[model samples]
Target chain A: MNIQALKTYLNCDNGFLLSLVQKFVEELNDTTNKITLAWQNQNLTSIKLNAHKLLSSVKVMQLKELTLSLEKIEAGAASKHISSELEEDIKQLDIQVKKVINDLQLTIEELEANSPCI
Target chain B: MVFKCAIIDDDPFFTELINHYISQVDSIECCGIYHNPFDALNKVNFQEIDFLFLDIEMPEMNGLEFLKSLTTLPPTVFVSGKTTYGVDAFENNAIDYLYKPVSFARFSKCVNKIKAHFEHTRTNSQVKQQNIFIKHNGIHIRLAVDDIFVIRAHDNDVTLNTNVRSYKTHLRLKDIYDMLPLNDFMQVHRSFIVQLAKIDKVDGEIIEINGRTIPVSRTYLGELYERLKIK
Candidate 1:
């Protein structure tokens, strides 16, 4: 996760990028929770929809690895039953999203420290 | 001139990102950001908008479907994550297509294309507006220069005949003739100015126009012959 590279792509100030990252993390958390609940209930439709929604933000963040994982989960959700491998993929997706949230928080802190006002 | 634009996308993040990119360009203005295509369809006036940044794969009503539903569409640029929608976007006359994770560089290029398109359209419209307006029965009637067949003067009123209808206006024959294209229309009589293209057949001193035989006076006969290239 090259946070600086993503910021350059967005071409926004540190404050704006920080706000975007915070929003993205919040949305990601909510979507992950939805996927988990849908999986527990064996509602593949809900899982597919939630995973599809998550893909948009992940792709924007340029997290290629995470994007592929989410795509697999989204595709697998269309199936009647979740295979053991698909279950492992969902578990990995949760970990990967949380790791991104942590990395983004660190980036935000670094950005805040570099600001004159801070 | 600043071009007012609207963004119709299901994702709030994508809309926000596009809005941010639009702010970087000085000539483009963000008028509205609609998260729902259905809401945009109901609210947006296609004629009023200068540009539209649309996204495909939206829930409920997709971008392509929404575009199909519009009676008139502005220049549209499709911003989608999926590359498969590119073919359909161009087929529907979209100005450009920017794949998701759209960079500011890519978005700026699309804006340039839109500017060129607007300039081209404005130039064409200016040429089309070379027309004359006459007041008939308290209403101003506009007639294209090429559409007017003949102009006849009777005392104080001038009747202007066009391909569609005729209008009787209180204007001088000379005044209306001055407004018409000099090369296309010629005064063949004191009260009649016939569009050269509208003259079907000329027999002796009379010219047939829409079943009406208008006589060419002797004073202007030589000039008419010169205009018609008659030996």
Candidate 2:
């Protein structure tokens, strides 16, 4: 997970980036779980809203593919169509988001380890 | 001059990123940050801040609906992950629409626009804050803009209700309204124009100011609510 882009976009030092990414890592599970639950409940509005919330952080994390996938989910949910394709997309999104979370966790570890050095 | 701003986004990551960007700009400051629109709606004093950073989608109240429900709002910029709300944002008179994961470069541009807008409004308010001379009881009285709280029209004459006393002048209600600062006053009824800041409470169609009740007509009621900060 390359954080150089996130750092450049934030235009802040390592300390601020670590704090923000840590916060994102902390809240990521609950946010993705909300999306999953909303999908299971077939609550399209909740799905769209939660997906949009996740997108906000994913974009800042500089995950282009995840951002695009989330956008598709948000739009699909808004359309109120619970189709096989949308379900597949959501399933794939869950996998990708989990991987992203793992990567963010590693990034957090690296930042924390390097904090004293900086 | 440093301007105060508030951020209302459910996404803490986005809020933190935006807050960081705001801290970089010396001319702008973040006064508040709320994850829930409902909390912001109940707590935010629109008069205290120069502008707002609003998120369009929240679990409680969407940003567009939140902005609509408010009787008064500072200039707002909608920060959302979706690209679809651009037109809606502008329709609601949003200063700008920022797509989520906003870059520092884009945020800086938005800051410039807000600063320019406030500068224009400040210039207009300075020009609007002059005293008006009116004849009351055969005497030409000079009244400051802040002195009058209400203006009511009866026949061909209008009464200027101030804090201390009331003065009557032979002027049209529209004329009296035109003379007052537009931001501080609103025409709640055809025969009544009340200073928005001086409003004590509103019960349905009636607005109370200084222990006096003024009727708000249907024509201007919606707009009157839109202009005053309803708690």
Candidate 3:
């Protein structure tokens, strides 16, 4: 899992993503694990709906890479034709997103640490 | 928002035509098409559909009566070869009525009418925002409500100029007016709707927008002043 890429994906400015993590973080060691669980459990219906809502909001915010990746996963799942190899690739992509989120949070903490709000 | 269109007509050729027309326009997606109205209604019950391309004189359930049966109805555009139903169709407050073998040109006009209605409703809903979904060759493009810098009404169609690209939608000035947000847009001339915020300055007859001159018609100059609230 490319944790760095995952950090970048989740580090975006959408509150929904933050809320998404907060909603499901307890279920996995990483974002990929959680998303994979959703897929393996045959929750594509929920995933497809969430992916679409997120796509529109994310497009408005200009998160092109993240939006595209989410679209690919959703479209494949909805079509019910994605290979196991593609699923593995999506899992890797999930780790990349997790890294993005981690980096963004760390950067925010560092900026706040260097400055005194008091 | 993408419009999921359900088409009900016995003719497969016309159904195919409707599908072809829908495929050309990105705004309306063809969700389900049925020769039997009852079958179509069953599908509608299960799926979330936004628009219906209905034929009035069907075998089982008539289009008009079916509309009455809907718990919640989206806008509909009627397609029929006979002209007798045109007035009744319009009276039903359907978005637009079309005669069978719907031409691309007429189809475009119908789409414009629907877009205009949605635009107005959306503006009223948001109070100060207007957004348009543009479908050019089956691709839906969402433009920001305020991104339209100016709109130029040409020979038959209107060209929307924004900060990014020039979008050509088949529409007339009168039709476009209803869709534009009242707060941000004002018809200053016969062929122009200037974004009030985009107007750099207003002279006696002309206003400069994006370094281009837009005329203020004698008929609409007063309207512009009212819109501008110029003291």
User: Every model's DockQ, to 2 decimals?
Assistant: 0.30, 0.61, 0.01
- Candidate 3 lDDT, B1-231, residue by residue in tens: 235568877555456545755666656667788877778767774334556788876644777877777676667888765568887777765788877545556677888887787666666755444577765455777777688888888887778889888888776665555566766777676578878998888888889988889888766677677777786
Q: For residues A8-104, could you state the per-residue lDDT of candidate 2 as single tens digits? A: 7778777888898878877678877888898899998898887878887877777888989988998899898898877888899889878988888
Residue B193, model 1, lDDT: 93
Between prediction 1 and prediction 3, the one with superior TM-score is 1
Model 2's alpha-carbon lDDT is 0.82
Question: Candidate 3 — which residues are off by over 4 angstroms?
Answer: A1-118, B45-47, B129-231
Each candidate's interface RMSD: 1.6, 1.0, 19.3
- The fraction of reference A/B contacts recovered in model 3 reads 0.00
Provide the overall lDDT of each model, using Cα atoms, as 2-decimal numbers: 0.81, 0.82, 0.64
Q: Which portions of model 2 show Cα errors greater than 4 Å?
A: B128-231
**Which 10 consecutive positions of candidate 3 chain A have the poorest summed lDDT?**
A20-29
The lowest-lDDT stretch of 10 consecutive residues in candidate 2 chain B is B118-127
Candidate 2 scores a C-alpha RMSD against the true structure in Å of 13.7
The digit string of per-residue lDDT tens for model 1 on A9-93 reads: 8887777776677778888888899888887788887888778777878887888888999889988986757788778888898
Q: For candidate 3, report its TM-score.
A: 0.37
